[model samples]
Each structure stands twice: as C-alpha cells, then as structure tokens.
Target: MPILKFPPIESADEQGIVAIGGDLHVESLKLAYKKGIFPWPISEDYPLAWFSPNPRAVFDLNNIHIPKKLKKFINNCSYKITYNTAFERVIRKARDIHQNSIHGTWITEEVIAAYIQLFREGHAYSVEVWEDKELIGGLYGVCFGKFINGESMFHIKDNASKIALLSILSNIKRADIKYFDTQMITNVTGSLGAIEIERPDFLDYVANTTAEKEINFQNFSLHLDFDL
Candidate 1:
C-alpha cells in the first residue's frame, strides 16, 4: 500500500488536478472517491492525475431523464442487460471505444488491474449491454452508498451507450441509489439528464453515505429505471 495524501479540493488550481503519481492501490482509489476526487490521465504516457472539478456534474436519481426517443429505442431493442457480469470486458471495451472517440485514455493496463481488484473486493461493478450474444456497449464505475459514480462507457453502434446508461439507472434503485456521479459534465452526459452542482455540495452528499451504511444492491427493476 502506498502512503498517498491529497490536498483539499479547494487547493486545486483552475485545472482541478490536485495531485499526481500515486500507485492505484485499492485503498488509494477508495480514498480518492471518498474525497470526491478521481483519476484521469492526460495521456497514455503521462503519470496519473487526480481531479475534483468544480461545477461537479451528477444525475439526480429523482430526475434522471431518458429522452423519449431513447426510451422508445430501449423498449424496442433486443438487448439483454446484466450486472456484475463480464466486468473486465465492459471496462476493456469502454477503454477501447472511448479512446477512439476522444484523446488521452486513462484506462491503461494498470488501471484495469486496479479496478479489477476493486471489483473482486465488491466495491466496483459494471453494466453490460448485449445484443444476440454480442457485447455491444457498456459502462463501469465505483459505487458508494446511495451513489454509483460512472467511470467510462463505449458503444459499437448508435445508442448503445445510452442503453447501458439507462439499464444501470433503471436497476440501481434496487440498490437504493439516489445519485449518479458523472465526474464531469459533457454534451453527451448533459443530453442524458446529468446536471452540474457545486463540488462542495457533492462532497457533502457523499459524506453522509459510506460503505458502512450501504451495500452492493442486487435485483433491479429494469422497466422502472428506463421510465425515469
């Protein structure tokens, strides 16, 4: 285990990057989450950079809005969704597809290994969207009590990522999740009903919920989550 420490998020300069170059041990990742900070490597060759952005983006579970067209698409699609199934594949694919669409991927082999450890520890999970036995799209993230903080997602076809998102949101209610932290706001997430709040507000939100009080949820209501 590495002896890692972070400056208060308030100490972040305009860029929101708080620290760099800590091993991604499970404890360090957990501590980062607890502090509302996350790792996003600027480039594959760059050292790890931790960020806790201001104007933090999050989804209000009570107000997660699925566009009517996406709702119709999900209702009409032949996708089979499952939880904690193919966790590695989901993360791998998310890394692949996301890297293609954007520059600088943080999902290095080391990141995969660390998150796999977290998954084995039951602190991280994934949502897979399968079509006819083919895994098309999915997303992965860490979950704390009342919150499932999404990390990355990818899609092979149109609306596949949306399907994965809707699936997780629909089912998380079973785990009693009230928030979905997007980490940052983008046009893609903004379209899916993610709204930004202050960073301090987000810190306060997670402070009230911890692993001691929340358990990994199972058996979700798929139909209900898509409706939200």
Candidate 2:
C-alpha cells in the first residue's frame, strides 16, 4: 500500500483517520509517527486506520502519582526493572492480557511485527519487570521528541504493571520528558494522573514541543525506588 501523508487531519480534532487500508510496513510506521499518526484499527484483519485523536490523553511525567502502597512496594521490592531488554516478551504479554479482557485485543500479529521493527530501529521501547529472572510484566511505547506514546501494559502479578509504570515515570522524571501521551482516556490511565486536554491545546503543545528537542532513551536506566 502507498504510504499516507499528513495534513488531512481535521483542525477541530487534529485527528486524521487516514487510509483505512494498508500494511504495517516499517517505513510506513516510521513516517506515520513522525507526523503524529498511529494505527489503531479494531482488529488485525481490518483495514489499517491511522489516528491522531483530539483531546489526547496525556500524562505529564512530573505529575504521575505514586500511591503510598505502590511507593512502598517499589522502595523494598527485589524485582528489577529493565528497558528494551525483552520487547517481544512484553508485547506478547500485553496481547495475552488484552485477549483475556472483555474488550479483547487489537495487538495483532501484524502489529507485533511492526512494533518489533520499530524497536529495532530505536523508535519503540519496553520496560520490563523481573523476579528471580522470570518476566512478570512490562509496558511498551513509541518515543518521539519529548513525548512518549504509551501503547499498552500488562502484569502477571498484583501491581506488576503498576511497578512498570512507576518505573517509567521515574525514568521520564530523571530524563525530563515533558509529555507522556496515552492516546485515549480510561480508568486505568486516569488513576495514573493522565488528563484530557482540549484538541487545540494538545495540538499547540505538540507543535511547540515535537521539533524543539530530542529524547534519547538510552541515556537512562530503570530504577525501582518507588515505595511499592
């Protein structure tokens, strides 16, 4: 399929639900994200529809709230947090968890392959949790400039994913990331301090920040100091 270009995204929403049919090619994925587009079709077999939603759910890394209990767990837990050490494993766990949920999963095989490619190219990253060398939970996302678009997260044990999130927030705090995009709103995200910004406000922020700075995830390592 031909790669879709930017500009069709409506001003009211800044969301261009562009090109409902295409493959998840590496070039296509990179181009899409570079222009603020992301794939979120309903299923693997459905046509690929890229979106830049209005009122995007975003968490200012500085604003993430680590609850007292979670903070305690992080402060004393023996589990270690690592970055990009097991991207595929994290993706598979997310898919498995989503499939078990009532909402089902959209992380198709095509999506998996596409993200793995993104990881290889240094645009995608994962935060992993290990206990006794066993992978328990993690989260993954695409990073562009000062923004990290959180895609999905899963946990095998209680608060495992929460630990991953706390770890991510800590890393972002240490790295000075300005925005953590959640794409959409949900209770899970809401609990983590994500908030909705009006479309215009979001677009303005994106425009002002995306090109002004660069973010390199390799400069930092995960720290499990949250009092989980």
TM-scores for all candidates: the values are 0.92, 0.88
Clashes (backbone N, CA, C under 3 Å), per candidate, total 1, 12
Tens-place lDDT per residue, model 1, 1-228, is: 753688878998688888887878889988898888888867767788899888788887788777778777766778777778899999998787767764646788889999999999878988888888999888899876655688998888778877878777767644567778898877778898899898888888878765445555465543424646
The lowest-lDDT stretch of 10 consecutive residues in candidate 2 is 11-20
Most TM-score-accurate candidate: 1
User: What does candidate 2 score on TM?
Assistant: 0.88
Candidate 2's residue-wise lDDT over 128-222, tens digit each? 98888899889999876665778999988778888887777777777766677788878778887888776567666666656655667676666
The lDDT of each candidate is: 0.79, 0.77
| Model 1: lDDT of residue 86 | 92
